[model samples]
Target: MTLEADLRGASAATVRGAIERGDPLPGTAGFAGLVDGALVRDVLGRELVYVDREAAGEGASAGARAEANGSASVWSFDPGGLADPELLPAGSVRPLRGDPAGEDRGEPGGRQVWTLPDPAPETDEGAAVAAVRAAVRESVDEVGSTGLAVAFSGGVDSTAV
Candidate 1:
């Protein structure tokens, strides 16, 4: 079963279309800042669970394992709310592959190849600043809210916002 939760803005529309068409997971670029949370099952039952990187620890239990990818960790799903579940080693378990409904795409999880944006910046500070400014402007325009709030930590990134 496909499940999406608290999707907002452009993604809410685009993903809704994909879901309606029974399409595999759609491109996620449109969801950059608007996805409050989302969980969707690919045709093979591989669930893509989105959680805040900051409070991710709160979702873990003794039986859950955390797979580190770069600076982020993907926590395994706990079958029950019990304090202790069978914790597999990090990276030991892979997402289940294949579609039970007989729609196999010859790929793991029957997932679609979604295009992603190239987030790399050119080697120019001025260009980087301009790009950031334009992105911020676009976000503000999309928000269309009279009130604005920033999750500030008084860091350089926060100050830039």
Candidate 2:
């Protein structure tokens, strides 16, 4: 049975709510119905989109489903360590720490942002520092940058970076 057949008569909100409630629907093996469609399991034993019901019904198809998920994909990863390296290509970048809203700081320019791997280690302070240092070194080496500027907003991560 295909995902569409399983969700053909279901509403997006209903499917999403089932996933949120951890209630797996039929014809879904290690998969869950998201707001869009069924999330199929990937080679890395991760669940990706088997079929994007929203896009298909809307007559849209161009980019991969991964891009459509965006930040929502973060939920696919286990809440402990980094995601499998293969899932995240080499050179993929993301925040070293903290949320994207930059709510941890008050002043606008006071927040610090460091681009690291998408799924960073939960408590690996040493790894975080090393990633930042490597990024700085790479920038200086490749671009011959004479000076560097880091935004410090009194946050522990910002200060460390």
Candidate 3:
């Protein structure tokens, strides 16, 4: 039995493209980030990501978001551990140079406004089920014997490792 990731499930390259495009939720789970760049959350906003408020500043430009060396000051998947972290918007490709609006959509000052993709069609029920299983197996294997917690909504793309 093999598990295929859901329609939204994406490989590393695919995820990178999606993040650049600001499409729908990434093919993987709920979150993805570029090292030393902007931190991106899933379109569905299923996952929670935090960034340090002080470091991010108010309306920091893309170059200002993270240091030149790509240091993410205080971003974390854990909500409680963040020190004065703010929740990034869902489907937002942030830290742009200035306002994403009223300018070219592509890297205006090193930032892009997130554009949501079309909704996925619900087909391939059998394939989706198989993929679900595969994702679970892979996730468990990656986690090894460590205790893991998964929150699934009976739909694909939610069981993020």
Identify the candidate with maximal TM-score: 3
What is the alpha-carbon lDDT of model 1 when measured against the actual structure? 0.36
Deviation in Å, model 1, residue 14 alpha carbon: 7.0
Model 3's C-alpha root-mean-square deviation from the true structure amounts to 12.5
Cα lDDT tens digits, model 2, 1-161, are 22342222345455445434534342223332222322222112224223322333343321223333242222222322212212321111111112332223333212111122256454888978998899988875796436866678887777546
Residue 59 lDDT (model 1): 37
- Please give the RMSD of candidate 1 to the true structure: 12.3
Number of colliding residue pairs in each model = 0, 0, 7
> Regarding TM-score, does 1 or 3 come out ahead?
3
**Candidate 1 on 1-161: residue-level lDDT in tens?**
22232222234566546545655446443331111122233333333333323323343221122343323332234323222233322111122222233223233222332323456668998998998899988987798556766688988888666
Residue pairs that clash (backbone atoms under 3 angstroms), model 3: 3-134, 4-131, 8-27, 9-27, 10-27, 36-70, 96-111
Stretches of candidate 3 off by over 4 Å are: 1-12, 58-72, 96-161
Q: Which is the winner by lDDT between candidate 1 and candidate 2? A: 1
Error of 1 at 124 (Å): 1.6
Ordered from best to worst TM-score, the candidate numbers read: 3, 1, 2
